[model samples]
Target: MRFCMMESKGKRGVAASRDGGPWHVLFESEPGFPGTVDEIVRSGEGAFEEAMSAIEAGTAINPDDLKFLPPLTEAGKILCVGLNYKAHVQEGGMPMPTYPTVFARFNTGLIGHNQPLVRPTSSEQLDYESELAVIIGKKARHVSPERALECVVGYSIFNDGSIRDVQMRTPQWTIGKNFDGTGGFGPYLVTADELPPGCKGLRMVGRLNGEVVQETNLSDMIFDVATLISLLSEAMTLEPGDVIVTGTPSGVGISFKPPKLLKPGDMFEIEIERIGTLCNLVVDEK
Candidate 1:
């Protein structure tokens, strides 16, 4: 099952589809329904069954008129992994990491599909990092690697847009990654069962204005999903609706000789196999 959160005519709703069929939208006005994607995800399987019923009973809307929202608006945690891919680490001239490089992105930076990534007025070093987003469905603490995937509910795509200059300003990456409207997330959340275990062997491709810029097999990650989950859970509880952005592959603009940084009107797209493409247009900050 795939779930999408959207708004049309100023009303928020949840749209669901089975096997990529027509979308059935249930508005917030619906009785006895958890209207937001985060609600259903937090409630677990029971809520999914309830949502399925609501979706079937509700009307299907023309997608052309709906404005997409990030799959979860209120995720308790938005943890991001950096340099998980060997090539990505090599591109930045960093040594192979013995542990995952982690960072946090505030929700204020998130934007949905077809949204604009505001290029901050402070710099022109905006770069794109295409990655997979793991959505946690169950509470987990100190989980083992073997059972780590059991806590995931679904997967989505993410563009870990970075402000290069700011990111390199300090050793910490938080300030550079949390710029408003720079994180591109969503389009849909496809459940875990629909994908291979740990989403291994999938291909991730990133494009800038129709030209391929980054490409890699997800299996190439030095620290795969289960390992990252287990590692992260050891420190903090992974709650439902929490998002873990797996790290990106190499070929980012910053790695180019002249650096193909983003500018207004440039389109950045991230596509992962079995998931969907997340596209965003760039715009200069006013």
Candidate 2:
């Protein structure tokens, strides 16, 4: 089942849409959809049983009645894997990594799909990265690749907005990628069972305006999702609501022949097959 957080009556709730219309509220703050999403995840195979019941009773909310929010409002931390895609490495003039390259983003960077990505006046090297983000359903550490799937709650899309100038200023990329509102993750979370095995063959595409700019398949990932999870768990504990952003494909601004960065007023969209599209507009920093 797809799960999202949306605004209804000035409060946030879990919802789903139908026919590309407004959001339908499934669970609210008092009822706590985040808690419900967690409870459903823990329920394993029976997670959607209640939602099904609601549908049968004709009490389910319609999709066209709510406003969207980041899929998870309160993940403990956002863990990101970089350079996992071979094409991205090639474009950046870097060699493929032997182990997963990791980084961290504070929750302050989090923003919802369709939200605005602020273009900082301090830097003019804005870029977009379309990636698949994995949400953890349970606490995990030192997990084996064989069992890592059990800790995943679902998958969502993330646009890892970057400022190449800031990123290249220092060897570390934290400052460039973690600016406020740079991280766009949401639309909804699609459960693991709902997705194909290992997310192999999935297509991730990014568009600037309506023109396709970056396109790649999950098959091109040097280190697939399962291995990344296992590798990460060995070093840090992955908690329920924790997020992991799989790396982006090539075609980022910084990799261009002369580097084409995003200016204020540009729009970007990241689409992952079987998940959903996350679209955001770039705006000048206030």
Maximum-lDDT candidate? 1
Per-prediction tally of clashes: 0, 6
lDDT of 1 by residue, 28-136 (tens): 8876556699989988766776787778778887654689888888999999999999998999999999999999998889999998988998988898999999999
In the range 1-286, model 2's lDDT, one tens digit per residue, is 6777666677655665433444445455343243445445555555555653442332256544456678776677788888988878988889779988888887788788778988887877779999988888777899998898888878999989998778888877799888988888877888777787667889989998878889999878888888888999898898877888888988987777777677777889999898889989998889
Model 1 / residue 150 / CA error / Å: 0.4
Q: What are the models' TM-scores? A: 0.97, 0.88
Candidate with the greatest TM-score versus the true structure? 1
Q: Could you tell me the TM-score of candidate 1? A: 0.97
